[model samples]
Target: MVRTACRPRWSAVVGKPFSAFPREVNEMIEQFFGPSAANGSTWFAPLSLWEEEGNFFVDVDLPGVAADAVEITVEKSQLKVAAERKAPEGERQYQHQERTFGRVERTLVLPESADPDSIEAELKDGVLHVKFGKRAEAQPKKIAVKST
Candidate 1:
């Protein structure tokens, strides 16, 4: 009989396997960040979306980004948010650098119910809040039933 040492698989040590992530997750990552090497200087601003009272809302985290450096646009059924975070001016030796400085952009597809004309956006406390009101037809309508 031969004896051999056992070793744990990479997936076992990393929890979920790389393939365990859903396709949509991979697609979303690609859509938001693009290929890793495509733009090494570029970083992404995390964001969240939700719906309430027949309206949609999106909030994006933009830590050091300036309001003037941000741009929001809507075309057709798509909404695009872009911003730039500039690094500190003047030359300095940095002990450590973790924060990212570059252009970051995200494009979202608005639902058919979304009203582009009703969209509103505001930036405060390093967060960008975007709200999209629902179309008149898309708003919930209470139906009445009549008895003969």
Candidate 2:
């Protein structure tokens, strides 16, 4: 079993399945969760990725985070989303508190034909919606010609 130690800057990690994940993901997850996060206990069911009808959608459940606390970015064909969840103030001790918090990020390599120019992102009712379109070149096109 491979082991990793991540701490400091634990604010830049994104957790996803290793089989479907990349090295950057491990780095980001470690950066956010710190050295004690690699045991799989720090994250449960990391973010999910999906698609339908030629459109790609990523739905992240961030119950305790506010819209303004999240950061979403698209760079070099990769989309990165990060956020921080803070417990309510006033030194409240908890016997057990298990809610994804502190910082979480998800990175995806958009299809080569993704249209970064026409992307949209919004957080509503505790869920984040990041939308983008596939380039016409990527979508199947039809052509016709008259025959004599």
Candidate 3:
């Protein structure tokens, strides 16, 4: 009886199946970079909401987004905020670029007693702040009577 040699099914350094790996990965893996349309990426900016002195305040961080690129509106007791930014002018080569540059729209639901006419918004140093007065709310009242 004769025994034939069986080839070893080896994997890459990362320990993945050789056949399962794509052929492009085995190649030099193009080290160049190019730009892509970032017109719809997940937003990473932080936002905060607070209420004080019969008013509601909203603050959002938009570091790279310009004031002109942002739009704010209120409809049906909800605030909508959107921002869009374009890529830089110069050539940028990125091995792993992770900057979002898309139209971002966020909906902020407000209480039914929110005053929309008095809403105000401002952007400074990449920080957006919005404030709106609250509508008058009727609360429980108690009355006391003396002996007649």
Candidate 4:
């Protein structure tokens, strides 16, 4: 006889096991308990970073975020991206919720080669694209060899 493992239906409701709920749900529970509520919750904007051609690139996911709401800054060799996604106006009950709304931010350490002054950023289609150019001395240079 062969047997297979069985899982509960609620397990896939939030793309997680039933035993573990989403962060929002956990926050709600914590708020009701009134113990860790003062700690507050932290929201982060998902991002991807890569380097190519002596340049660094970053793409941050900012769904439901306005372009004007984002703020980017570089100081002390660190790049900071901060934004907020406001909650919908009016009161309404939600059957199932996964998306989070509030202040979202991400920070990354800039490499020595990165030129903070040459950094550029743009927000399009809910994605924040950032490019960091390398300093002239950091770029590769071709050395010609000659017969002596």
Candidate 5:
């Protein structure tokens, strides 16, 4: 008679399959981040930030949001953006909802070289664009050295 060694699966030893663990985690994430009820719960939006030519640019996605409802402020080394997105009028029932609504706020820590006074922002095409100019003193300066 020939016998072969067999390895025990982790799920089999734990009673529940390991594959179900990921699904449970996903459900928890969705429950926390996904939209809830009809007019309750807060959600986060996507933001893009980058730097170019001694200037920092921040792009915030704010679709379905009114321009008048948005506000941007620069305080110390922190940049704050606040906006509100109202849901459509006469809402009945939703089978599946993913889009976020209501008050939304995002804050970013500015670089040490960022000039708060030179900050500018404009919202166009449902996207909020903010630019921060670096301080002149923070820019690199050329120095001349004498040959020995």
Candidate 6:
């Protein structure tokens, strides 16, 4: 059964035993606490973390958000990113408001090898690209062996 915002429909699975219990329970729970409330009213932007070469990359999704609204900082082994997304002005009617607005912060604990001083961030095409350079000692090194 389909569920509406005000009313939630429930259906029981008759084919399999105990199946209806789990499905019905989950459907009811999701009605009250859905994806929109996963992070509360103020939502957090999704970010991807990966390492390439000797640099660590953090890509944050901030579509429709301005660069000036974003703030980045590094302290010890922690990297913090904060931003706010405001809703457009002069709206007429709304069906569903999924986009998040307001202040959101995400702090990531970086590796010890990451150099806090060597950090850079850039916003382009609604994406915030952050790069952190690894210390020389942390980078992979090749050693040559001479024949004895």
The candidate scoring highest on lDDT is 1
Where model 2 places Cα greater than 4 Å from the true spot, the runs are 1-36, 39-45, 145-147
User: Which candidate do you rate higher for lDDT, 1 or 4?
Assistant: 1
Q: What residue runs in model 1 are displaced by over 4 Å at the alpha carbon?
A: 1-41, 145-148
Candidate 4 collision pairs: none
RMSD of candidates 1 onward, in order: 9.1, 8.5, 15.0, 8.9, 12.1, 7.6
Worst 10 residues of 4 by lDDT: 1-10
Report, for every candidate in turn, its global Cα lDDT versus the true structure.
0.79, 0.67, 0.69, 0.77, 0.76, 0.78
lDDT of 4 by residue, 1-148 (tens): 1222454323445554554455446545555664234334344567888999789999998988999899999989999898988889999787666556777667888888899999889999999999989999999899999998
- TM, every model: 0.73, 0.65, 0.62, 0.69, 0.68, 0.68
Task: State the number of backbone clashes in model 4.
Answer: 0
Q: Between candidates 4 and 5, which one is better according to lDDT?
A: 4
lDDT of 6 by residue, 1-148 (tens): 2334654355445776565564456455556886334444256577899988889999998887899999999887899888988877886476665555687777889988898889999999999999989998988899999999
Which of the predicted structures, 1 or 6, would earn the higher TM-score when compared with the native? 1
Q: Looking at model 3, report the run of 10 residues with the lowest lDDT sum.
A: 30-39
Model 2 C-alpha lDDT per residue in residues 15-51, reported as the tens digit of each score? 7334334445665666677633653333422455566
lDDT of 5 by residue, 79-122 (tens): 98899999888956876665556898888998898988998888
Candidate 3 overall lDDT versus native: 0.69
Q: Cα miss at 6, model 3 (Å)?
A: 45
* Candidate 6 TM-score, C-alpha based: 0.68
**What is the RMSD, in Å, between candidate 1 and the native fold over all Cα?**
9.1
Q: Residue 26 in model 6: shift from native, Å? A: 15
What number of clashing residue pairs does each candidate have, in the order they appear?
0, 8, 0, 0, 0, 0
- Which residue pairs show collisions in model 6? none
Off by over 4 Å in 4: 1-42
